[model samples]
Target: MTSDADPRFLRSREAILNAARELLLESGPTAVTHVQVAERAGVGRATVYRHWPQAEPLLVEAMATVPMPFLDKPTVPTREWLRRELTAIARQLDLDDVRAVSTTLANTALWDEDMDARRAQFAGILTTRLAAALDDAQARGEITLALASQDAAAMTIGPMYYRSTIERAPADPALIDAAVNALGTWAAG
Candidate 1:
């Protein structure tokens, strides 16, 4: 029997995860079934079951492997920096695979406790950055936000999220500008 730490075992695990992620990105959450993953990975169904007995956990792990984009630290004015970051986020959300996996995460989280935590954790990738940026801007005396950084992150990104994930539409550029302007105004108060 191959030990867990064996190189072959690790390679197989990586293959399984890559296959599951491919299916999720290509055909959404339903395509991540053990049979599909096993077939795609060229592994036995029993192998997939051995790693993740539940499809939800399997799906979550696969989704986790999909990278969240990050921009370098701000080198421009905070508002400009925020625009660039938000624009990057909008562009990311515009991808078909991103929209599929994101919706899958949100919908699945409604029913699965583990998935819910994962969803929040995944979402923090953006919000945490947003919060940090806002805090940094405040420290620089560039803007004063009455709301907490976390709340501000949500407020700014919520529209983009809704457009891409909920409405199944691209995030409009105008919406991005509007969000930035609105946040700036809110922070100015």
Candidate 2:
């Protein structure tokens, strides 16, 4: 009978993922080699490779484990929920691990078929969530004017990305509030 305490059970896929996440946070994607991950995880290089043959997929999986922000549709109204949700997203964007993942995605030179597919999947997740939030807000009469959910989402998230990547500045609560207010004004106009 196989014991649950076997070494295989001890070093599960999650252990590998955690080790990879740490490496990505510390040294970026380029440093996430199989040997390096094995050293960090205290596992053999062969074991790491056996679990994840390529580095990009492994990194992508590690990144996916990082929680993406989502706004819960509230029975009250969309505007209130959006304000809360955008604030949360802004706060999450300030996290070092989140910034590291964004930086890694921007710098990855592997633009092959697999990477393209993965990028599309990642984008879809963001797009869908943003759309839902905007729709909920519209339904609640929070946004008075006609604006596409996609555009609103872009406007809301773009500044956060700019501050995180281009400016290399931490996201401030005041800044997020300002963005939300601006969006609300535009909608009301």
Candidate 3:
């Protein structure tokens, strides 16, 4: 067994992960088997299986490497922030790769405990960012949320996911505008 501190081990791991990610983007999650990843990584099948015993966790980890749209920019007014957040979500969901990976994550997570935990962790990060924005707005006295920021985030984000992934339709400008307007009304009320 190679030590984790070994440079070769790290390089091999990185290569395997990158290969898995490429497979996911090129052919979707169904293509990300141990043999396929090993072949793509130029490593042995044992190496891939040794590192990730299950295909689901490996796929989830690869998807985690994806760069998600974030609310990391400078803070803006609440309304502006909400609009920008929704717009970002719509744009990300519009991507074929993101949609495919997202659907895979949602589906595999149902049967894999590790994947489910990873999925929850990913979702928590997004929800926390959104909640922070809502909390900031409340602090500024811009809007009063009738529900918690987490709940507000669900209201704002759930529809975009549904429209893009479930409906297999673009998250149109009208939908974004309506989500923004509806959230504003709910918060104001």
Candidates ranked by TM-score, best first?
Answer: 3, 1, 2
Q: Candidate 1: count the clashes.
A: 0
lDDT of 1: 0.78
Per-residue error (Å), model 2, residue 96: 2.5
Tens digits of per-residue lDDT, candidate 1, 95-171, equal 76566667767888999887888888877877787788878888877777767888867787788889888787887
Judge candidate 2 against the unseen true structure and give its global Cα lDDT, from 0 to 1.
0.68
How many pairs of residues collide in each model? 0, 0, 0
Give lDDT: candidate 3, residue 28. Answer: 62
TM-scores of the models, in the order given: 0.67, 0.63, 0.69
Residues 2-22, model 2: lDDT tens digits: 365777755666678889888
lDDT against the true structure, per candidate, is 0.78, 0.68, 0.78
- The residue pairs found clashing in candidate 3 are none
Could you tell me the TM-score of candidate 1? 0.67
